[model samples]
Target: MRCFVTGAAGFIGSNLVDRLLAAGHEVVGYDNFSTGQRSFLEGAGRSAGFTLVEGDLLNPDVLRPAVAGCDIVFHLAANADVRFGTHHPFKDIEQNLIATFNVLEAMRAHGIKKIAFSSTGSVYGEAAVIPTPEDAPFPIQTSLYGNSKVAAEGLISSYCEGFGFQGFIFRFVSILGERYTHGHVFDFYNKLRNDPSSLEVLGNGKQRKSYLYVQDCIDAILIAVERADAKINIFNLGQNEYCEVNQSIGWICDRLGVSPKLSYTGGERGWIGDNPLIFLDCSRIRALGWTPKLSIRDGVVNTLEYLMANPWVLDARG
Candidate 1:
């Protein structure tokens, strides 16, 4: 199969690209480096079956050529930071909504049929159920980032229904693993690496959420692509276990061998659109014969080890 992955240099996208290439598939990767890094795609470039295209999804010229001759399109590009959306709503709108429209349009033009979209658990907002299912009603988004994802999902659904494209939407939880340039784990590691004496947490540390390792995330998408035959299939991708913010801090502290003074701004939700608590009912995806192997502690430890080895951060505090 020939696959085109947008945000191909991002943490999850890069991981997925490697998996696709390993499965003997030709992959064309596209990224603007907005949040993605070229270093993440370096390994894929070395593969004979892999090709990289430098471009933004907002540009049809770049998108159309990048997506040409691809059997499946994995649309992962977006403004991923939830906090950034609060500061710049238009940035999220353009990067997510506009960028997604361009991808769907390009796919339509090329007569491509399948798309596995990278949606978010944030789209569910604050769920009433502990393990929310695919049938769960997605509420009005709490943040601009979440709103943008909701819009993107809608666009994909519309394309599937109106244009007869096969689509799979995976609503992802907190993803943590190697090649991660940003996220809670990365933020904590950098803070402690620079100043081991103090760690500033975003929320009051009581907020809880589900997490998924990068490998598990990639595997779930693969399963979706291979098995999904519906016009629009939706799945919640996450680990079954839930972890609190303070518990995550403790795990990081234990792994890094640093006990810092933990301080937090008082709030349930960390930011404007942040959901304090939400656990995914991954049974939908699990029923498809895929399950996450990494526990919260295991995933955190692995991520810490990766950061220690990679050292993407600088000793600027010194």
Candidate 2:
């Protein structure tokens, strides 16, 4: 099988690329290096089945060829910086929604039948249902990033129904593993390293959310793409449980041996688009014989350990 993966140099994208190549599939990786690291693809680059392309998703010319002749496309390219969505209002629209438009158009043109997109739990936007299912009614989106994902998901579904494409939309919680670059774990680790005396938290130390390990995340994607048969399949890929922000901070602090005074700035959420609480009901994907093996505590601890061992990622993220 031939796979074209956007954002293939990113944390999850790179891991997915490695997984695909190891499974004897030819992989064409597309990335712009805006946030994705080149070193992340070191192993993928060495694989004979892997081909790396340097390009941005916003440009159709760059995207069209990458999509050509690929059996499947894993669309993971997007502006993942949800915390600062307001800083550049159109970044998410351009990078996520518009980029998805380009992928769909290209896939349609080339007759590519399958696409697996990386959606987010944020699209649920303070969902009314605790442990929100994939079919849960979506409320008003809280963040621009989440809204962009919602738009992308709709486009994929429309394309699937209208153009006969198979779509796998996986709404992910926070993912942790090696090459984990951003999010709460990264923030907490960087803070203690900079100042061990105090750790400044974003929310009121009560923001709780579900998480999945990157490997398990990839497993859910593969499982859905392989086992599930549907014109449009949407799965909430996450752990069976969730952890609070304060709890995660405690775990990170314990691993780092730092007793930093915690300081939280916001009330219910940390930022404009922040969702105070999120826990996805992942039974939809689990029904297809997929369950997360990593616990939230182990994921957090290993994330800290990876960042600790690879201190270069912090500087590289700059």
Candidate 3:
């Protein structure tokens, strides 16, 4: 199969590109290097089956033609800056919501009937349910990032219903593994590297969150795309277990062999749209015989190890 993946140079996208190539599929990777790293694509560049296109999704003239003659579209590009969504109000809509519209329109123009989107668990927004299910009712959106994803999910489902398209929507918890550039793990590691004696944590450090390794995330995506045949298939991709923010800190500190003085700004949530707890019920995907190989602790340690080995990622991100 010929696969077209957006955000192809990103952490998860680059990893997925390598996997698809290994599975004997031809892949065309589309990316704008705004937050994507070229170094991440070194492995993909070696593959004869992989083609890289440099363009932004907001430009349909570029995106539409680039998407031509593709079997499936994996729309993974988006503004995932949830913590700073309020600072730049229009960033989420233009980068996420409008960009998704463009991708859908491009797919429609090119006769592409199948799409897999990277949605987020943030869309749940402080749910009343603990382990939120795929069918759980969405509460008020707490962040602009989540709001945009919610809108994008609706658009994808509508396209499936109105245009005979097959859509796979995976709402993921925080992903951790190699090529992890952003998120709490990256932030904490970067700060600690600079100042090993002190570490300032956000909130009260009790935020319980579930995470999935990058490979495990891609596994669920491929499985769902292959087996699930609904017009709009929605699955929550996450570990069944979760860990507290403080517990994860212990793991990171233990691995780094540094005990920094911990100080916290007294609050229940980290940021404006931060949910205090995020534990998704992934039984739907688990029923497909897919399970994450790494626990939250393992994932965190692996991510830190990657950062330590490749300090350039920290310098580049900074």
Candidate 4:
């Protein structure tokens, strides 16, 4: 199969590219290098079956050409700066929502019917249900990034129903692993690197959330895309278990061997629109013979190892 992955140079996208290549699929990567790093694609660039399209999806000229002649589209590119959603309000709409609309339109024009969209658990908006399922009702949206993803998912569902497209919507928790440039793990690592004596944590450090290893995330995506045949397939991709922010901080500190003095930023939530807790019920995907293999602590430890090995990522990403 010919696969086109947007945000192809990103952490998860790059990992997925390698998996697809190993599976003997021809892959085309589309990335603008805004948040994604070129270093992530260093290995994929060497594959004869991999082609890189350097352009932004906001531009139809570039988006249309990049998605052309693709069998399946893995739409993962988006502005993931959820914490600073209010600082730049319209970025989420343009980069995430509008880009998705453009992709759907391009797919419609080119007769591509299958798309695997990278949505998020943030869309649940402080969901009342713990271990939230795919069919869980949505509460109020907590952040602009979550709001945009909700709109994107709706658009994809509409496209599937109206245009005979097959949609695979994956609501993922935070992902951690190699090439992880952003998120709490990266933030903590950078902080400890500068001041090993003490670490300041966001929120009360009690915000519990689930996380998945990048490989497990891609595994669920592949299983759903290849096996699930529903017109609109929605799956929650995450570990069955969850953990508190402070708990994860402890594991990270242990690995770094820094017992930093812990200071609270004084809030139940980390930032505006940040859900203090997110425990996804991944049974929907687990039924499809998929299960996360990494614990929260293991994922954190692995991510720390990656950051330690690549000390330059912090400066390069920031």
Best by lDDT: 3
Which lDDT tens digits does candidate 1 get at residues 1-318?
999999998889999999999999999999888667778888899999999998988889878977889999999988887876767779989988999999999999999989999989988888776788878877766878888888999999999889999899999998888886677888888889879999999879999888888998898999888887788999999987898989989989998888899888888877787899879888988888997888978888888888889885323211
| Candidate 1: regions farther than 4 A off | 313-318
Q: What digit string (tens of lDDT, one per residue) describes model 2 on residues 123-188?
A: 999899998998898898789999999999999999998999999999999899999999888888
In model 4, what is the error at residue 180, expressed in angstroms? 0.5
Candidate 1 differs from the real structure by a C-alpha RMSD in angstroms, to one decimal, of 1.8
Worst 10 residues of 2 by lDDT: 257-266
For residues 1-318, what per-residue lDDT tens digits would candidate 4 score against the true structure? 999999999999999999999999999999999988898888888899999999999899988978889999999999999999899999999999999999999899899999999999999989999878888898988799999999999999999989999999999999999989899999999999989998888889999999999998999999999889899999998997899998999899888777889999998988899898899888889889997888888999999999999998999987
Q: What's the CA error at residue 286 for candidate 4, in Å?
A: 0.5
TM-scores of the models, in the order given: 0.96, 0.99, 0.99, 0.99
lDDT rank order: 3, 4, 2, 1
lDDT of each candidate versus the true structure = 0.87, 0.91, 0.94, 0.92
Choose 1 or 2, whichever is better by lDDT: 2
Worst window of 10 by summed lDDT in candidate 4: 250-259
Error (Å) of candidate 1 at residue 211 is 0.5
- Residue 16's lDDT within candidate 4 is 94
Clashing pairs in 2: none
